[model samples]
Target chain A: AQSVAQPEDQVNVAEGNPLTVKCTYSVSGNPYLFWYVQYPNRGLQFLLKYITGDNLVKGSYGFEAEFNKSQTSFHLKKPSALVSDSALYFCAVRVGGFQKLVFGTGTRLLVSP
Target chain B: SQTIHQWPATLVQPVGSPLSLECTVEGTSNPNLYWYRQAAGRGLQLLFYSVGIGQISSEVPQNLSASRPQDRQFILSSKKLLLSDSGFYLCAWSVRGVAGGQETQYFGPGTRLLVL
Candidate 1:
């Protein structure tokens, strides 16, 4: 079965500092990876997805992720973090020819001002 | 522009009570709809998905059931709710890709269910 793992439970960073949220996935075939953000008591918002393209995929809110096939990782990254960027982040993977997406346990991002 | 809506925003019911959560999508036709439960604000567990009207596929066997009577309307219900059913329920929709690739799923605002 396809699965995604987000190792960090929470990550704390200072405002304006670079931030990275790690994500690794396991799938039988080529993986369709995605990143989503969620605020308190709100549904998840799509950030970006990696189907087949360049190694790096840019997304909304100045966030981006890199798909490293060799490493089987798709890590969300931002050059500079903001206090508003603090939220829960999730990584999901969809195996080829599958409709269901396997999601990882979310990582809480805490940005200090 | 496409959008998804779910209601009621919050619900409180007894453990043995019934449950009915409704979700509808606008500005899109023949879109795939899904029902997911998020427990303790963590990873999401897909409960059901529908490729078209009257075609419901259940991913988990639990106290909940889903029905798609209309093209864009999906409903989740249960005859008797359980304490474990208390969580955030989300409805999502995605367009089917031509090449059979996976598409991005757009989620609704979600409904908070609390069972006493």
Candidate 2:
């Protein structure tokens, strides 16, 4: 079974400041990673995904993620935070050939102005 | 263009009462359907998925059950609702059965169910 872990429960950053949310995964074969965001009472919106190659993956809302095979991590990054970017973020992983997006507990991001 | 629709945007039900949630896809055929639940402010939890009509896969077994009567219609049903069932129910569709890592799941707005 594939599983994902989000070490941080919440992340806080000031407006215009850079932010990062950590994610890691455990699976049997090569992995496919994804990041998604959810606003209050809304369904999750797809941000980006990493299938293979080019360790760094970029997504919507000026957010990006780096896939590190050695560290078994895929951390989401943004150079600047906006108040509207605050939301619950999720990291998901699936073994190659299997697209059942197993997700982590999720990390809450809060951008302060 | 393709879109998904879910009914009763919000539902309030009493415990032990029967429950049913419906989802339909438009402008698409033979879609792969899924039923997911998200606890308040949490990530998605896949409860059921279907590759084709009458072929349902259970990812988690609890008080929920799902059925696909048509190629584009999926339904989540429960004989008796429970408090644990209270959460945001989401319906999603993928182009086809997942084979490798390229599949993307498109989601509906979702239905918020509150079990009182």
Candidate 3:
């Protein structure tokens, strides 16, 4: 079975500092990875996805992710964090030829001003 | 432009009461619809998915059931609610066919369900 793991329960960072949210996935075949953000009492919003492309994929709200096939990781990154960037982040993986996605438990991001 | 909508933004029902949640999509045709439950604001568990009208695939077996009576309308229901059923329910849609599996899904605002 395909699965995604987000090791960190929460990550705290200062405003304007660089931030990283770790994500690792396991799949039988080619993996389609995605990053999503959720605010309190709101549905998830798609940030980005990695199907087949360059190692780096850029997303919304000045966020980006690096897909490292060797490491089996797709970590979300941002050069500078903002207070508004604080939210819950989830990593998902979809195996090739499947429409369903398996999601991680999610990591809470806390950006302090 | 495409948009997804889920009704009854917040619902509070008794444990034995019935449940019916509705979802609709606009500006798209023959889209794939999905129902997911998010427990404690964490990961999402896909409950059901429909590729077309009258076509429903259940991912998990629970107290809930889903039906797609129309091309863009999906419904989730249960004869009797359970305390464990309380969670945030989300509806999503993606373009069907032509990279459909690889397509990005757009979500609705979500509905918060509380069972007493």
Candidate 4:
């Protein structure tokens, strides 16, 4: 079964500092990876996705992710974090041609002011 | 300019009570709809999905069921809600890719169900 793993439960970073949220996925074939953010009591908003051809994918809010096929990782990153960037981040994966997405447990990003 | 809406925003009901959470999409047609449940500190679990009207697919065998009577309307129903069903329920929709590739899903505001 295809699955995603977000190792960190929470990550704390100061404002304007670089931040990284780690994610790894396991799938039978080529993986379709995605990153989503959810504010408190809100539904998730799509940040980025990696389907093919690109190792590094940039998303909304100046966030980006690198897809490493060898390590089975798709880690979300931002050069400079903001206080407003604090939220719940989720990594998801889908196997080839599958519509259902397998999501990670999620990582809470806490950007201190 | 597609949008998905789910209601009521929050629901409080006793265990064994019935549940009816409605989700509808505007400005889109023949989109794939999905129902997901998110437990505290956990990832979203896919409960059901529908590709078209009257076409429902169950991803997991659970106490809940889903229906798609209209092309853009999806409903999640449970005859007897359990205490375990207390969680955030989300409705999502995605446009089907013409080339059979994966499409990004857009989520609704979600309904927080508290089964006491």
lDDT of all the models against the reference?
0.95, 0.90, 0.94, 0.93
User: If ranked by lDDT, best first, what sequence of candidates would result?
Assistant: 1, 3, 4, 2
Q: Model 3 over residues A1-113: C-alpha lDDT tens digits?
A: 89999999999999999999999999888899999999999989999999897989999999999999999999999999999999999999997664598899999999999
Residue-wise lDDT of candidate 3 within B42-105, one digit each (tens)? 9799999999999999998899999999999999999999999999999999888856358888
Candidate 2 error regions (>4 Å): none
Alpha-carbon DockQ of candidate 4? 0.69
Q: List all candidate RMSDs to the true structure.
A: 0.8, 1.4, 0.9, 1.0
**On residues B1-116, what C-alpha lDDT tens digit does candidate 2 reach at each position?**
99899997999999999988999999888888999999866868899999899999999779999999999999999999999999999999878755685777878889999999
Error in Å for residue B52 of model 3? 0.4
**lDDT of each residue in A1-113, candidate 4, tens digit only:** 88899999999999999999999999888899999999999999999999898799999999999999999999999999999999999999988674578899999999999
Best by DockQ: 1
Model 3 chain A worst lDDT window (10 residues): A94-103
For the second chain of model 4, what is the TM-score against the true structure's chain B?
0.96
Candidate 4 lDDT tens digits, B1-116: 99999999999999999999999999988998999999994689999999898999999898999999999999999999999999999999998754444689999999999999
State each candidate's chain A TM-score. 0.98, 0.97, 0.98, 0.98
Clashing pairs in 3: none
Q: Which wins on TM-score, candidate 1 or candidate 2?
A: 1
TM-score to true structure, per model: 0.98, 0.95, 0.98, 0.97
TM-score of chain A of 4: 0.98
